[model samples]
Target: MSAPMTPDAALARLRQYGERTSTWSTATYNDGTEKALHGIALTLAAELEQYRALELGTAEGRVSAKCERAEHPVWLRDLDDVRGCPWCELDRVRAELAALPTPPEPQIPTCISCGATGGPLRPTGDRYPSGAQQFVCSTSCTGVTS
Candidate 1:
């Protein structure tokens, strides 16, 4: 486990962001946020799996008497152990999503002649004047938008 961000570092990062005027985009901060969450997601997944397995083993009583494991603890205990409340924090959630299993590639209308397939189609925020997935015409063939 890594140490939590120190107050000084966080304040410095925020101060850096304040210096910028045009757009408040901080690629480094964004990257840090994503990295932190990815670890959290993995940690949560592992914790969840461990809890489930322990539960199943106890239920089945397959765990040997000699092995001797403890009963399932309370939610608060588990949460405390796993550093819970990630759901309440935007940064944690973002990190978790960053590490989440990605959905399968979307089915797209491919250009038959050129055999060009579109990349993962996520929201680009701004609505284009034409309101279409931009495509290009090439020597192989003409392309169209989704």
Candidate 2:
């Protein structure tokens, strides 16, 4: 008679089957094989969950057996073994990013003729009434203001 499959072996099998099924195409897919794999995976997962529940001895001790962010199994002994939830980690990163100081905007030279700001500014080669050098927009400017 064949030996029973261990939880570790079942997990490994599930991972192997998962990888294989992910790359399967319609042309090469087998319904029987897929169904069998699903049934086996579901049974193994349930058994594993039950095993963990029994081992932990409490509902509160029933933490996730896998890391959602990494999509990998986490052999946790207790709640302390949990690093953090994926959403919590993401929110923490967002908060840190939000806390960072935003850089100041660059000063744009103003056009003295049209009072326009931004875009290219060029010297009008003329002086304002206050003897200050005047600048104008490179396009559609009416020259220096009086």
Q: Which candidate leads the pack in TM-score?
A: 2
lDDT of 1 by residue, 1-146 (tens): 98897745654554444444345246744767645544555565556556666655553344412112234232222322444333345556788988987534324534433445553333334432444443323344434344
**Per-residue lDDT of model 2, residues 1-146, tens digit only:** 99999868978777676557666555445647665766677677777777777655555664545545565434444666656555556778999998988644324456865766655778778864445656778878654443
List the pairs of residues colliding in candidate 1. 37-95
Give the distance in Å from residue 82's predicted Cα in candidate 2 to where it truly belongs: 30
Residue 10 lDDT in candidate 2: 76
For residue 82, what is the lDDT in candidate 2?
A: 50
The TM-score of predicted model 1 comes to 0.23
Every candidate's CA RMSD: 19.5, 16.8
Number of the predicted model whose lDDT against the real structure is largest? 2
Q: In model 2, which runs have C-alpha deviations exceeding 4 angstroms? A: 1-6, 25-28, 60-146
What is the clash count for each candidate, in the order shown?
1, 0
Local distance difference test values of all predictions, in order:
0.46, 0.64
